[model samples]
Target: MCWDDGMVDPAPTDTGRAPADEPAARPAVRIAVAQRVPPRYGDPPALRRLATAATDANGADLLLVPELYPAGFRLDTDELAELAESRESFAAHLGAVARTHRIAIVAGYPERGPDDTVYSSAIFVDADGTELAHYRKLHLFGDETAAFGRGHQVPPVCRWRGWGVGLALCYDIEFPELARLLADRGADLICVPAGNMVGYSEVPEVLVPARACENQVFVAYANYCNSDDEFDYDGHSVVASPYGSLLAEAGQDEPQVLMVDLDPGLQAAARAHNTHRNDRRHDVYRGPDPTIG
Candidate 1:
C-alpha cells in the first residue's frame, strides 16, 4: 500500500467497538484504482492503455478510472458535444473490457443524452457485462460548468457481488450531502472518478476520509496524473476506509494502480463506535423555529 505522509496507519488495537467473537457480516471485496494520464480526444492508444490496465487488474472485483477519461477533461463545450458518446456505444466497449477481464468497472465519460443535451456521466458494469447504473454528475466543476449540462437525478446504489456500490464523479464526491444520501440509501461503498487537479489535494487528504468515516462506508477515488494543455492533474488517488484510514494511496506525480481489500468487519466496528446515524438530531436539522419563518 502507498502511504500518504499525512495519514497514519490504522494498525489493529483494542478499540471497544465490537465483541471479539462477532462474525463479519459482509464478504471482503478488492478494488483497483488506475491513476494515469488520459489520452487526448480521438486517441485510440488511450483505449489500449485502459484495456491493459483492466488486464493487469485481473483479480480485483472492480476497476475504477478517472473522470472524462474517454474524451479527456480539457475539452470545450463544442468539442465535448462533438465527442459525446451514446450510452449504448459506451456500454458495448466497457462491457467487453469488463467481461474479458472478469472484473467490474466504474468509469466516467461524456454522454449525449436523448434530449439532445450532453452531460458528464459515469457507468457501472458488473463482471458479466451487465450495465447496472448510469449516473450523470450532479455537480459540475470549473470548465465543466460551460462544457456540459448538470444532472437532475441522484445516483442509484447498485448491488454488485454482495456489495452496495454507489457512483459519483469528481466534483460530486466533495459534497458531504451526496455521500450521506448514498449512505442513507444503503451504499456500502462509493466509487469516484475524478479529474482532481493540482489545487484540490485537500479533497483526498481531508474530505474523502471524512466522508468515509462519517458515513461508515469505503470510498475509492481514481484520478489522473500528469498535465494536459490546460490543466495539471494531481494524482493523489486514494481508498479511504470506514475508520477514516487510508487503505491505499497513489502519489501526486506518478502513474500507478493502487489496490486494496475492503473488510466488512472494519466498517462494522466503526459504525459500532461512532453511531453517527443513530445520533443525528434530525428534528433540529429539519427546523421549524419560531424566529425563522
Candidate 2:
C-alpha cells in the first residue's frame, strides 16, 4: 500500500489523523548540528542552553540537536513525568527562540502525552518560529521500550528550502525500511535527532551513509557528546550526501557545532544516477508464508 508502480515514486501525503501544513521548499539551505553539554534529569534550563548554543553561535538556516537531552535520555517513568513538557509550552518557548534566531530548529524533548504517556519527541520550528513538524520516535532503543511509549504515526515528509524533508529520530534511522519509505515517498533530506551510544561506528559510519547512498537523499544525524548514567554517547555526528559522501562531521568526544551547505540540485543528480529504488523488483519480492503470517 505504501508503494505504487512508477519509474519514480510519488510524493508522500500525510496519512494520520494529525494535521499537517502545506510543504514549502527552497533551492539551497544551510544546516547546523550541535553537540552540547548533556542535560540532567528534570532540567528544562539545560535544554534551553542546548537550544541557545545551537543558534547562539555562527548560525545557519536550520539547526539540529540530539534526542531528549532534557531528561538526559535515561529517565525512568517518574523522572520523565517531571521533565516532559506540554506541547503548548514547548511551542511557546522554542518558537520564540526560532523566531529570534531567524533559523529553523529541530530539537528533541520528552513529550507528555495524554494518559501520562511519555514520548521521546522532536519538534521542528521554522525561521519565523512557526511550528512545522512535531514527531515522536517510532523505534525505541533497548531500555527505552520500558521507559517510553512509542509514536503511532509514520514519519511525515515536509518540504524545506525547495527539497523534501523527512522526520526521524535515533533508533528510527537505524531501520532501513523507514529511510527507504521516506526516500521512496520523495524525501530529499532525512533529519535525525539521535542519542546514539558509544562504540557503534557502523551506525554513523555505515548505515547512515548507506541509507543516503541507496536512497539518494541527504541524511543529517545530530547526537549528544557525553557519557552519562544511561549512555556513553559518542558524538561523531555528520551530514551525509546523496552520493554517501560526508559533508561535515563533529569531534568524537566534544561539544561542537557542525555546519554544511546543502544543495538540492546535487540530490536531484544523485537520484537520477542511483537506480536502486527505481530498479526494485516488487513482483519478485514476497513476505513470509501465510501460515507464518
- Candidate 2 lDDT over 1-293, as tens digits, reads 22222223454443311122222234578888887657765446853685566555455888888888566677578878887888777877788878777888888888888787889988887888887777888898778889899987767666566566788898888899999878756577888988888888678888899989988889999888878666688788999999999998887788888888888778768867877876775655665555663
Task: List where candidate 2 sits over 4 angstroms from the true fold.
Answer: 1-26, 42-44, 286-293
TM-score of 2: 0.86
Judged by whole-model lDDT over C-alpha atoms, candidate 1 comes out at 0.81
Candidate with top TM-score is 1
How far in Å is the alpha carbon of 201 misplaced in model 2? 2.1
TM-score of every candidate: 0.89, 0.86
lDDT of 2 at 40: 62
